[model samples]
Target: MKQLLVPALLALLAGCATTPPTPLAPTGPKIDTTYTAKGQSSRARFLVLHYTVSDNPSSIKILTEQQVSAHYLVTNGPQPVIYRLVDENRAAYHAGVSSWKNYTQLNSSSIGIEIVNPGWTSTPEGGRLFYPFPQEQMDVLLPLLKDIVQRHGIAPENVLGHSDIAPLRKQDPGPLFPWQRLAQEGLVLWPDANRVANVRPIFEATLPDLFWFQRKLATHGFAIQQTGMLDQQTRTVLSAFQMKYRPSDFAGNPDAETAALLEVLTTPANAPLPVVPTPVTTAPVPPLPPATPPVPVVPETAPAPAAPLPVPTPVPPAPMPAPVAVPTPATPPVPAPAVVPATPAAVNTP
Candidate 1:
């Protein structure tokens, strides 16, 4: 009995030893080298904004290296300079576990730009701990964003933040991010205030049936399913939407304002077209004539007939009489030609 007990214990120990270990969670930065070879050409679109919730560039740079690195980093200072940390072509280790419309894993298709600022929340005690973005930083960001958006052929709506794509987890470029200015520059999408006001009542009445709102958000490239009920996922998606469209107040509730804003955003007429500024000519240039130049008029002239050439007379040949057939002796019948058997041609050997 003692020996059997020992063997049983040993068997239990062996079983425990052979059990599989738990898999490690995905940690640290996601360094994707798939696009490194091609650079910007490898990237398909531009995801144009972010905020490094760090006080300074050095801290942000260190954090980015230790955690994740964006394609570009703009410093927060009086005279901000844009730093190209990673090539635009490579997939920067930003945008973790994200989806937008048909696209999933946006890092594969986007170039992320991080703005250095200490993005923080105010305490109930009313302490001003949150560091605001410097004007100079935004000034630098706008032109850079424009260049990237134009070069990559990224649509105005596609220029979204890390929070917009991964709303459940992130909110880097928060409400303070200059979305209005970017919209004015035609870099991002902005809801028309008047259009949103008009659509407010419709969204409010249909708030109970969230499916309608979810469908519209999905149509506008947000990754949301029309589940009818306002679930946790729906709330998260709505929070993301609020962060982008209604940043001033982002409580994640399906309020009239949020719905109205969404309605305006989804409408084509409300969407701003890409402004093409006419090139300003410094030197005074002469204006060109009309597209269809005027035809020169010609005076009418009377037509005159010239003298006709003399017609030649027809020549007549002398008429000849038909000869009569001479009668001749009957010739003997010709004999049939003898038939000969043709010889077969000899075959030639190669």
Candidate 2:
């Protein structure tokens, strides 16, 4: 019995040793990290700048908790801190219903940076006083902008303000925002001062019409209607441009300086200045000839000659019909009385 037990235990041990442990099932998918495709580009195309019209705590809370969000938020202070709320690869809920040039709905293609600042305050005289951004905040923002621009190869023209994209609705990063600083950093396009000076006089002599203003604004990447009138929408878009380029007077009115800036920005270095339409004046009509006595008209004694009679058209004679022969039946049919049934009924009554 002992030998049997020992042999049984040894057999079980041998069977267990001979059988390989069942391979553990894989818990996750395996991917090879050997190669990467070069034909790829970053999802972010434009860098839109904005201002958070609230304090740092409120801004952070609203951005994180509310539906609206941005990729980065630069807090306001002497030493401002930058917080990246959303990943660069993901779309932020900024730039709602926005457009730049031909692109629309910029939230899908842009990375938004919201700087903490009180947007604006209304003055007693019905004017707005926009808040200025701190230099430290700008300093932090510039490096971030440079990094993103370098990584994504964003164009200088693509660096836009929230107001630039949504001129009809938004006015963030308002007139006080330092656009010249961005220009200096080579993040945005700036019109040449010399060119602006040279072209300003031409516009000063005669300002371009509203149509010209709309065209130049559209050409400069603002989404404006080509209305030939100075409509509110046109004025708003014009004001957006002025807020960026000429902050002193953003009243949306077309001035010589605005015209020069627009022309210089939109026109190529070699392109000729657009011809301004000359105002047309009507010539004064000569005084009507002094009224002269009406000359009595003489009526002809003979009546007008009778109209000539219309000539009658002669009718053509009808052509003779060709004779057609009809075949006769072989046997003649007998004719029946037409009223035979009525006569039979009268005879029955009789």
Top candidate, metric TM-score: 2
Q: In candidate 2, which residue pairs get closer than 3 Å at backbone N, Cα or C atoms, i.e. clash?
A: none
Off by over 4 Å in 2: 1-29, 269-350
Model 1: colliding residue pairs: 39-89, 40-89
User: Candidates' lDDT values, in order?
Assistant: 0.77, 0.91
True-structure lDDT of candidate 2: 0.91
Top lDDT hit: 2
Per-model TM against the reference: 0.60, 0.70
Q: In angstroms, how far off is 49's CA in candidate 2?
A: 0.7
Model 2, span 58-160: residue lDDT tens:
9999999999999999999989999999999899999999888889998889999999999999999998888988888888989999999999999988898
lDDT of 1 by residue, 1-350 (tens): 99999999999999999999989988999888766454445355757477877657575657466768888888877888777877876778788898887889888889888888878867889833445677878888888888887788888888888777877788778777777888888878788776766667665555636887789779877777778887987898887788677776676788888867776777798365323345687987789876997788887787787799899999999899999999999999999999999999999999
lDDT at residue 64 of model 2 (Cα atoms): 100
TM-score of 1: 0.60
